[model samples]
Target: MFKHSKFAAVAILAISAYHGAAFAQDAADPVVAKVGGVEVHQSELTLAMTGLDPQLANLPEEQKRVAALSAIIDVKLLAADANKEGLQNDETFKQRVAYLTDRELHNAYFKKHVVDSVTPEEVKARYEKEIAAIEPQEEVHARHILVKTQQEAKDVIVALDGGKDFVELAKEKSTDPNKSEGGDLGYFTKGRMVPEFETAAFALEKGTYSKEPVQTQFGFHVIKVEDKRKQAPPTLEQVQDQVRQLVMRDKYVKLLEDAKAESTVEIEDPALKKAYEEVNKQQADQKPQQQ
Candidate 1:
């Protein structure tokens, strides 16, 4: 329910260090409105679009701008009145303003030094390194016909032996939801299926069906192996975003490490200091899932 005035000379954008605020500060930031000679820039309105009421995220674009404009106008009007009342000289207000300004500067620095510094080449190289580190694993491409009883499974094998199309038989007879897709299980590595099903599916020769019904907790299954191959590593396109984050996280940790080594971080509270050290140590010892 909170609105855009929260960002107009008020709270700093807390999201990604208010990344858009940097753009708002550019020269020739088009002036949309003015109050007492103070012009509201396009960048400020853009920040309000996001930092304002989060619920406005779902609103249409024009509505969001209108809402942001209204909020900016309200704040400017009250701000002018508050100036007449000499509220700007209040000590607490000045301290709060100073703190918010410092926080904004920190965000601007982070945006420049960390977020924007990561390159596409860096992300791709990291992704390649991660993929290279993963050991090759075997995978199987198979299909199955699940039925409730042993007799039904045997009948399925008999039909396969009789040259009945496995996919069509599965569509007509299988109990699994994938029956519609001719019971195709696609490709899977070991441990993805029940022990009995895995054993039966993996043992069959390519382009062959299980000669016997395989029993598992789920039910009786007649399996067919379509092919077998080493499981492929995920493509960069499939995991590029995750790899980018990994790179950024690593860069940020390095920055912190260098900064900490150069400065004295004093913790006045003993217990809090211990906890802080423990958290930092844990982070240092941890490995990202990309590895």
Candidate 2:
């Protein structure tokens, strides 16, 4: 995840403004703080506080003010010393500052155009459209007695036919873990179970057990169909937040694509262009995986 380090820098800036002798000794609006004739103003402290750590925002008013002032003073002292050492004239320092400035501008643009512009109505409309396109699905409720061989399954059927309770027969003869629960498989939709088992389970009428044992990699099964019903779709309220995220992501993507299409974007380096395209493709592929 991306993180912003602006808060740390701003806090230090705020500390510098408050502790310099000019502000501490003077009693006036926009109090000027000076360190060897370099002046700092209280307004600089206010601007620095704008980027303070969000977690510190809820502190008591006095504590927040004190911390902000302390941060401004520290920033001023370090900055003054750095200027004295002539670091500001270094080419590397200038390049680093330029890079950070561009990055901040990019982030501000995304916040204004993508994050802030996403609306609740758009999210709800997307959810409704998705819900309307869903198809009703069928599910089966079933139970089975699992045994090691077809002969054992046939024998279990014989016992059931001879009036032995299926639950007791399962308890005495079945090897599956569900034998403890009378072999009840509860409810499941198609594609959830192995093909052989699912085919036989769904083929039977309600209350009927398979006369011929079904074979699967798990073993042989004498399955009983308990019930069948159409599976219910999830209600919008149950997935409202998920739908909102999906809609916002779609909007953000469309906005980016539109901007790119409308602009003259030239990649001067072949390697960089390839890397950028690869990253976009990777992100596109991962969106479905996230869903």
Candidate 3:
């Protein structure tokens, strides 16, 4: 039964593809597969598979080919029916085709000029330059006891002063979700925490808890700074793929900028003209802010 089902599935796909090419001239291409006097081509199958799910791409070569052939046949069958009804002449169909064609062209150009041109050496150089420019920033490992009120936070700090284990107190009393992990926040750089909490946490010495309850928008917190160290930049192997993406994006932006500068550009619509000017002005203003 299973073998019959499989053969039926393959037969249906071949038939669909054959019917899809029914409108095309029989003399156009000998590559076409004929089903009931209809034609299907290899290109149709290839294009069909290009849009398949990513997981399908991982299938064994034979299975992938079979799936692609099936999908192409289905697409051809639908296309033939649509043509028969003259749906191809519809305004909506024309617009959809135009949009899809333009998007595909843009993607093809980006892949050819930017993505394909990016080399490993370029990515490595960009990463090296970025590492050189980065200033050593301090990071801290800390823990906190969160409470609903200032009084509750104050009591927690008092317990800390009397030699109670910060983690034990946090587990028993803290309202924050991290209480289960003994309030360990792991390591983080400055500006990651709220200003009030950051200020108190950064000022504390290693192994010392905040003497007072620190008030913030979340609530009151009793913080203990566990350690402080210089932040380490990511190693090349750790972020090689990310570095490649950054380099490619930078190249893509340059390509577009160069194209725009070299082109004869015009905006015929008044609303679009005004919007374009505003965007240009905003971008120009941002340059000085960065400086």
Per-candidate TM vs. native? 0.80, 0.62, 0.60
Please give, for residues 96-210, the per-residue lDDT of candidate 1 as tens digits.
Answer: 9999999998788777878899999999999999998899888899999999999999998888999999999999999999999999999999999889999888888899889
Q: Model 2 off-target regions past 4 Å?
A: 1-84, 270-291
| Clash list (residue pairs), candidate 1 | none
Candidate 3 lDDT over residue span 112-189, tens digit each: 999899988898898898788889899999999999998898888778888899999989999999899999999999
Candidate 3: residue 96 lDDT (0-100): 100
| Worst ten in a row by lDDT for model 3 | 282-291
Distance (Å) between predicted and true CA of 102, model 2?
3.2
Error of 3 at 25 (Å): 23
**Candidate 3 C-alpha error for residue 123, in Å:** 1.7
**Which of the two candidates, 1 or 3, achieves a greater lDDT against the reference?**
1
- Candidate 3: residue 24 Cα off by (Å): 26
Residue by residue across 1-291, what tens digits does model 2's lDDT show?
123567777777888876765665654546546655666667766776777899999988777766777787788889889999999999999999999999998778878876787787877787778877788788889989999999999999998888888778877888999898889999999899999999998889988899998999999999988899988878878998898778767767877779888997789999999999899999888764323
lDDT of 2 at 136: 76
Pick by TM-score: which candidate is best? Answer: 1
Question: Ten residues in a row with the worst lDDT in model 1?
Answer: 8-17
**Model 3 vs. true fold: TM:** 0.60
